[model samples]
Target: METLRQYRENLQKIYGKNDYWMVPIFRSLFSMTFLFFLSRYLQMTGKLGNPMVILSLGLLSFFLPFSFVPCLSGIFLLYYFYTQSILLLGVGALFFVFIFIIQSSVRGKYAILIAAMPLCFFFRIPYFLPLLMGLTMGLSAVISLDLGILVYYFLRYIREYKDKFSTGGDLVEQLDAFSGNLAPFIKNKELFLVLLLFTLAALAIFVIRNFSFNYSFETALAIGLCLESTAFILYPAVGMKMNLTGELLSFLLSAVLSIVALFFWHDADYRGTEFVQFEDDAYYYHVKAVPKKKA
Candidate 1:
């Protein structure tokens, strides 16, 4: 236990010392990934799909603050949407405006959740958002997670039905079509089940992390993975008709990604604790806390 604690502390120290550089690298990587997937999803061929835009944005993201990356990505997405369809552009703009209002009202705390939406779509790892948010953020993050899911499904629906909207129609017709596309998402039992599973997983992680034990993060992750895996397995059996293998594969990948994210989160949040030692006149203090190992 001492060795594990020391190792974790060392890892945290290393990260803390280099976070200035490391953060930009991560931001750039995330930006590039988001752009790549966005282009592919939007079918932006020719110059639009060229690597130049991605590389340029990645370089720009590296130089810009982390907060700017999401905004930059949003601009890129809007440009793509405009090129595709004015209706899509309008809807996308309104959606993002709503997100902006929410974030502004909340002091930008849920920005990461908003950013996670694109990555979730690209990686088929929407479940990780709730898990991560639940562990690191407050219950309010549930709202962001839901909004992210809504954006994802909406974008997907647009892609699938882009052909139907190729020819411009009356505003009422377009609105009706958009509303129709939303029905399945609202009514689909599978989607709601997935959302419930994520909420429970996040709540489970949050609860475990507060258990006054060592390795709480790991335990939380393990429990969350089990919960998610169980849901994936049982979803098809309950008449969802999903592809079990694909679902499992996505879940496994998401779990791995979530673990990596948690490592960084743990290190960032707990880095100074190991070296924290202070004493008042009342008592001399020494502390070396160990995380609880799984039973």
Candidate 2:
């Protein structure tokens, strides 16, 4: 435990010392990954799919505000969609505008977390996201989580309909394609489950960990995993086909990853001997005492 704490402290110190350069490099890598995956998945590598251009954009992301990544990504997506379907591009544009509005409201504190939701979905470790957020965040993060889910589903809609959309077709055909892609939220059982499992579970875990009790974080984390496991049984009800063995293996992996994350991010937050209490409109807050970081 002593060795682990020292390691955590050293990692924190390293980050603090290097974050000036480190932040951009990490963001740049993420930008490149995002663009590459989008292009690869679409199987449409035009100028936007050029490796050199992607690298240049990554470098630019390092220099400019990270917001530039999403803007470029959005414009690129809209233009791509425009080639496929103008009405579809219009829908993407609206989503883009709404995201910017929400981004401004949240001050982008959880932007990385939110942006990572789809990536998590792609990597099949989406179960890790809510628990990590619940461990470190407050209710304000709900917006970020919701936005992330929105982006995930929006991209899914694009993928599902891309083959069906008309680049130049009769108005009736375009409308038909657009309307089908705009499937009702209630019809998407997975969406409902995600809200219940990830969003609500995270909020519940947040509340549980903040309670005045022993081992609250552990309890909360355990319960979060339990909730996740319960979701497997719900797959059939949600109209989702399941591969039981594969899912079981994924659960084990997600559980291990979640625990590791808890260690690296949460447990490292060692506390001093003081307890503090504060409150907001919705709930009271109990802050664990800790030595302040060095100046």
Candidate 3:
């Protein structure tokens, strides 16, 4: 424990001394990574195949606030829809507008949930998003996460069924078909299972973190992972096909990343050794108080 405390103190000192530039660098790196993958996904889908556009988006993401990344992504989706069909673009616009409103509202703070949703498809670790948000954010973040999930699935549906859509149909007919298809997608048992599992995991983590206990963060993470793993196992038994190996690997990576992030957050907020000096009659005394690091 003493060694661990010393290590944390050392980390705190280093971070405190160099965090200003380090933060932006890290943020830019994350943005670049996200954009690189996003562009790759687009290319793979044959949606936006232009390498230059992908490069431009990657550059744009590096400079844009993290909050804007999702919006830019939504725009890119819209552009893709436009290339496919005007009717598809119209549907995309409606979805984007709705999401935009929700994001711009007080819940906007949780918009990262939306941005992280698509990444889940590629890098399964993103499934930890709800758990992380639940641990750190208010209950409303769950709603943001749900909407984000819906958006991801919706976009995926469009991509997969684009060929089946009738471009010559009347507007109302097209919308009806779209709505009919979306209703089933939204009610998909697999989708609901994932949503329920993540929501419960997040809530559980939130509850555990609030308990007055040592190693609360670690405990919460363990509990969350257990819940996630259980769901993954049971879902397969119940007839939901999933890549178990990929999900397990993702969970492991996400857990490590979350732990590191938690450490950084805790250290950043730490107030180092407090001391007091007092003089008494016939004696002069100095006292020091050192705060213990929470496990």
The numbered model that scores best in TM-score is 2
What tens-digit string does per-residue lDDT give for candidate 2 at 1-295?
Answer: 7676677779888999999999989999988888777777676567777888878877778887665776767776887888777777777888888987887788565776556777777777777888878887877777777777777777876786776676668767888866765765327777768767888778878889887565677789998888878888899876698888877876778778878777776562345446889999999988766443222
Q: How many clashes does each candidate structure show, in the order listed? A: 3, 0, 0
lDDT scores for all predictions?
Answer: 0.72, 0.76, 0.70
Candidate 1, residue 182: lDDT: 64
Model 1 spans > 4 angstroms off: 1-14, 107-109, 137-140, 167-176, 213-219, 256-288, 291-295
lDDT of 1 by residue, 1-295 (tens): 4565577668778989999899889889988887788778868787669999798888898887655766887798788777766777887798889877766655355665666765786777666776777668876676666666666666676677765455468767876787777676557676677767877888888889877556677788899888877785667677777766777788778877787677556633233236346799998776655533221
Superposed Cα deviation of residue 185, candidate 1 (Å): 3.8
lDDT of candidate 3 at residue 91, scale 0 to 100? 78
- C-alpha TM-scores of all predictions: 0.75, 0.84, 0.75
- For each of the candidates, the C-alpha root-mean-square deviation to the true structure, in angstroms, is 5.3, 4.7, 6.3
What value of lDDT does candidate 3 attain over all alpha carbons? 0.70
lDDT of 1 at 162: 68
State the weakest 10-residue window (summed lDDT) of model 3. 264-273
* Clash-forming residue pairs, model 1: 214-291, 214-292, 215-291
Best by lDDT: 2
